[model samples]
Target: MIIKTVKSLSQALLLVALTLVLHSCSNPDEGSAIETVVYPSDVIPFMDQWKILLGDGTHTDEVEDYEAPNFFYVANDGEADWVVYKTPNAGVTSRTSSNTRTELGQIEHWTPETGGKLTGTLKVKHVSTSGDARAAASYSVVVGQIHSNEGNENEPLKIFYKKFPGHSKGSVFWNYEINTEGENAKRWDYSTAVWGHDMSVVGSSPKTYPEEPEDGIELGEEFSYEINVYNGIMYLTFMSAEHDTVKFTKNLLQSEFTSKAAIPKQILTLYVSLGRDGIERKNAYAGEIQYFKQGAYNQTNGKDPEDNMVWSTGSAIYDGDIAKQYANGSYTEVWFKEATVGPGTAPN
Candidate 1:
């Protein structure tokens, strides 16, 4: 009888010890210190601090609105197909370069010209035909401009922006068809994309985009193009463009689309043209983008329009306390204009 009583007491002690351990592990302050996992929602507040959302917290100011947003559903074979959303339709408007019919769907075009800024609402919805499908999660996205032209007049198609941060420069490259993994990707997540002229004519080689972050998708179910910039030189695979593997790289940047972001001091440049394909190009540093407001007098070449419309704009970089404006409209070509990479370095 005494041994039985002792065993019960010992079990009670072990139970108490287990409870204490669990309590310690669960404590957010002391003990094991519960680690708070940061999901997309958790980091949104920080994104707001950077002021990347369009329309602040409201839904009225849409960067570009579609009566129905584009939808791609996972087919029975586990492949995601580009399906149209009946409720919120999707199609390329007349403003866009591409002409996608209703059956093919459309995309609303919004660029710096639309507002010179991208802060707005994009409502996305999904409905499942099967009961076991993933629950439809709606989203509202804000796309902001990151970089404009390459600061060279010869190449006008180059445009960059923070589509959703935590991606790579190529994420914003020209004509790359971004196949997001899930629905409501723009607002629910972040990515970055950048593109430039591929000076090397050697050409036609298999290419890879910059490595994507764990929280993002790089080339998920999409035919991406090859127009990546490393160091100072840019590469473009014509084969990719010819086959429409991705959108034409030059057109991608020229469209002047703003993507949502989560960084301060985002630099956006819009390139006009990269000069001719085989002509002698000028140096890139010659390009100088000055302070020219939209609908204001542009003083780049002392050329003033009757309406005082600003052609393009560039950001000034600090060189040893000298804030020199890296003119996006300064050059005609042959040189490379280095963008001031902010604290956020390209993901290694």
Candidate 2:
């Protein structure tokens, strides 16, 4: 009886030992557990239709299965997953642009006559706050644009969001880069205000910030824009719950600023530093092939502000270290919850 009892005890002990060993091997260390990264495509299904150029000089035409760490990814914005396009102030620049971008370029290109439509609903999360406050491009990011593919490769539309440090609200504006007929080097952009002061608004000095626009967008506020080019006419609609919905129309086939006399006071003040006083082509963007772009195209850079204060931002980059830039508020991050790209529909 004693031997049988001892044998039973031994079996029970052996079973318990085996169970402990199995559990230890099966359980993963909580500290070392890996997180599943969400790609931009996972959050935004339309990513398959466009290609992307990351801030790190990474380009992928096939973005359906592509993902880049620290540049483009999925982020949770309290309510839902959002597609984030983030870029440092300084990084491996693109071939045609001096600034860094984590933006998408549409695969489809269309002429103004054929027309195209693009829409986006997004929120500006952050912009660099360490640049020259007086510079026009300082503390600004390009959220959407229309880029010409041929000729001088000029940009016809650039939707911008700019905020000075210590301000509660930022300005939203759009710029039109003239397709200069002769020399591309003499081109300049004409800006129009959407929700606040136009890009022409600047500070009195390099360290000074202009008066905050009474009607402007606060950080993380939601806004939507529609770019509809129908029958050579470009129509824009901007909507936000807090502000009045605004609509604008311009003829892309005809030139509005054909002579220096037609230039607005804002343009004169904004372009004075850069000497970009050239006029637009008589037939503005006519017969040009254009494509749409969306994401965080960081306009701020580390360039010396004295060179061209309007374009130079002198933001801190920490030598292209993305982690350091994030820590120092030297990065641009934008989130998009919904967007669509397709052929332009006939206007009602």
Candidate 3:
């Protein structure tokens, strides 16, 4: 009888130890005394291939085994580990951008002819809960991007995820900004839906929200995407466990929207009010140096909605205080479990 009692006690002790381990992993920022702390490189091992920009405008190229307390770190949500990218709605941003981010920029650049590929498996943990609903950038974040290093420095692609307050599901969409033929003042982006509504679907007023999408992703749901630019053609693949796989293709060496009359009706609706109707260059993004970016690029900001209805979010920011913003739900957080960066692969 005594032997059996000891065996039962041993099993209980093992379970208790596992619980303690999980608690430590889920809350790494609680303290720095954790000996089992894991860095982002420990999970993905691709940190050496990229540099990082934190929400507070901290840049670093030495992420071999690094972790920043509030901006970048590791988290485990019971099942698996993830590299967390978090940023407040308002903070120090790049010179060209108003929003903030804690993101990784690929060190290597490639032309459309040379080509490259980037893949990621991730989930959205949080998005700003307060914003003017009529604004397109409200309650949203950009997860991946293909940024140009030449011309007007316009983005060729941006993958986004957005959710409205009080809604259980959000949308996953992508935008393609036209390579303007002349002055970039008229540049505009055309959005396409991947899992739910596109950027054009917004609330009618500051407080009102559109009807929730029936086919949408929830916060903390896992999804994957593959971007392959091969021989001047860009191929995209998106997959989720509960949703059907989706794919798209675009030519970077050729222009798809070079003519004024060729514009889609959606673009007319989204940008006609802003007077942005520029056409793309004939060669599109050909011969331009481009790089990849991945992480939580916070879209919401404290800019007044009356100024620019599209990009302005008019969300609460706690005066650019990151700690207060995090405590009050004015931030974005993304977690990635898997990712890769290398040369492009021919499609099977």
Candidate 4:
């Protein structure tokens, strides 16, 4: 009978193509999953490791008053004015207005009072003339001493463990995630910013998240990061394999970076140093940690909601183009010769 009706229609088309390949491998709607970009470790162990006990340390006016909690101070507000005094340490912590500061930038964790690593001084000029017309000014002071930890922004590492007796409870909260693939796998949440002090090396983070998976389709690439240190407190997470692979050559510390607008263009600077032995040496965890990705804040749903309360960095200067200088402080540079955006984009 016609070869049994063509062998019963070729066994019903191989049982409907194996039931649609097991229903599309069990239905996967979302974006599919794949995204990664996180940085803060280009090596930078030290080269001269920032040692400017005074002037020859560079920049002057009696060496622009740097007491040495490590070191870094860059400033300039033109037009002319005054009223600067950044003194902390001796105990009085308070700076959780959430986030906002940049005019020059840098006043991070100002705490120092004879505590083995003590130093604090900032008195830049310009108070009136609307802080010098506002168009633009300059500032750059690179200092170092690394080690970071400071919680609260949703419990960075909630302290008070009986006033911090080596407080530890399995520490966790560096959560990093990114995603985006075919269907709709969207899931890119990462924004907590605020935790500085925990040094003894180990701030470089990266175990996985730099890849080339192969067969299963991951020939795309891969990368993942995680750094956790209890007691001394250190928690970092990067996790990026796709969503904009993430890459930044130099950015002299301004909270490592969150971005909105504050990086105009200057040679770029950094003198960041952290590693004062245990517990970051004498309490109050060293000083000088600056990085300002880009300034001019204002944004809610998209991100940076506004509050750039005009920070400060010693008499800044770097006419170099997309600025590039590291180690001295760690971030804040701009000097663009070309390539404004799109080599992979994402430095704004």
Candidate 5:
């Protein structure tokens, strides 16, 4: 009897040992299998400095550790992760404009005399392919800008990228919207070419395309821009590996078009339909408070090209359906690797 009892005790001990071993093996360290993904704020730390509006009309001021899945997110391009800003050709837009956009508006405001500086390194991934070629704004996207916070909410500066479908290259240009001296209805924009024809150049017909610029930048190509408004002087610098670097200087405190005679032919043709023939103020954007903006401000829309060819883009919209618009290639996507914003520096 004693021998039988001792044997039973030994078997019970063996069973307990096996159970402990199995439990430890089944539950390994919790940290071993988890991998963290980097976000847009990780690449560009300035996201917290401004507020963002998504293509779906999502507005948020907290962007430091925030990201929207389809509109604003981080994407890996085989080489590195980039912050992407994408928007449909037609979607919910801001109250002041009819165009759609996924862009950032700076929180801080400044005047022409006080000045500010903004820099960005980015690439245009895609743009709307279908639009009236004769329209001044068709098939174009605004990447960066300076907008007035008061008065007519007019823009002081807008940088544009335009490319026709099936074309190998696109034009890069910047526009200066006049701060009307009196009536705000007289406001107009003047454009300057960086690597192609200015905004004034357009096709004779809706289907026709002008000769491609020889020194234009192509889609997916990398480029950088610096907009420095220092001591009432606006200085611009554009750089790309495929073309020569370009630099321009304009006075923000003074008007280049004080009379109708100073208006360019492009503005005459582009604004003729819109009735924006107003002359600029003697002091262009001098005392007015302005803010900066960046991202994909889609210039295309679903409006009929026949009504207003220049501003109206006839792009396809699946009745405000985001997934359908993306599938149909009716959206704009831009990626930015680096950017900075701060007080303007003193001129050398």
Candidate 6:
């Protein structure tokens, strides 16, 4: 009888343990369901081809299975996954730029003749809301670029998206910085509009905001761009499902703004006060080493706009506190669902 009782006791204990395990499995608060976390590399597989610089000045080349909190990371918005690039209006930036960025720089360098291409499907999530409305660079962020890695490290192309506070729609534009013939200090970017007004559109006073673009893109609207430099010529295509598609062709081997007279009217209004009327060299970014960059290059800063109204943005930084700036709308965020880096293909 004692032996039989001990066996029964052991079986009862086993049954009790099984019941507890089943109950825990059904309880979400006490469940052991492992959630699979996603990384930027999982969403976009081109992390190996590029190195990244985060908003707080973190740089890394090995981005495989890597994710940085509140800066470079992956996000899911119910329907799709996105690689998010976020930065405050002010942060520890690289030596070359006063502005901050959480952007990817292409590892492979190429000349215009050698040719390369980059494509990104993204949407601008947020832009700094506190800035002088009259300042041209205020409330703006650069999303893509063809950056010159050599010769003063000037940028050949910078695609921008800007919106004033209280505006429902924003402008999309691209700027070409003159490969200044003599002085890099005199370099200026020539702006061209794709959907709405170019970078030159601004209010008359510091606090006044301009009218919203009628044919503009909203903050979360999707857009895509293709930058193809083939045989010393750069071909650009901007596309969106709700907006008209636009294409532009520019010659990298030749200068379009070689003379002062070639300067566009937008520049006259935007940079004439700063005396940035320098012209490009005859061979514009032809032999210069170049690379592609994509992400949120924050244009807003805490500088006084009265110093350089065209380029400076008087945004609130909360004494360089990134958390405060992010909470107060003094930040920029961009999300990319897709991106590609490869050799330039022949134009169709």
| Candidate closest to the true structure, highest lDDT | 3
Candidate 4 ranges beyond 4 A from true positions:
1-9, 16-18, 25-33, 36-138, 141-348
| Candidate 5 structure quality by residue, lDDT tens digits, 314-347 | 7778788988889988889999999999988875
Tens digits of per-residue lDDT for model 3, 132-227: 999999999999999999889999899999999999999999999999976898888899899999998999989899999999999999999999
Cα lDDT of model 4 by residue, 1-348, tens digit: 999999999999999999887776787653477654211111111111122221112222221223222122222235322112111111111243211112112223221111111111112111111111111111111111122223111111111000011112111112111111122122121222112111111111111111111211111122232222222233333333333222212111112222223211120111111110111111212232211111111010111112111122121112211122122212222111111100111113
Report the C-alpha lDDT of model 2 over 1-348, residue by residue, as the tens digit.
999999999999999999987887888573476888777787778887899999988998998856777888888867999888999999888888879999999999999999999999999999998898777899999999999999899998999999999899999999988888878876888899999888878888877899999999999999999999999998999999999999888899999888989887877777755788888889999999999999999999999988886888888889889889989999999999999999888865
Q: Is 3 or 4 the stronger prediction by TM-score?
A: 3
Counting clashing residue pairs in each candidate, in order, gives 53, 0, 0, 85, 2, 0
The whole-model C-alpha lDDT of candidate 6 against the native structure comes to 0.93
- Model 6 reaches what TM-score against the true structure? 0.92
Cα-lDDT of candidate 5: 0.88
By summed lDDT, the worst window of 10 consecutive residues in model 6 runs over 25-34
Error of 3 at 58 (Å): 0.6
The regions of model 3 sitting more than 4 angstroms off are: 1-34
Order the candidates by TM-score, highest first: 6, 5, 3, 2, 1, 4
Clashing pairs in 3: none
Residue 107 in candidate 6, Cα distance off native in Å: 0.5
Q: All candidates' lDDT scores?
A: 0.21, 0.89, 0.94, 0.20, 0.88, 0.93
Error of 3 at 199 (Å): 0.8
Error of 1 at 190 (Å): 28
Candidate 4, residue 70: the lDDT equals 17
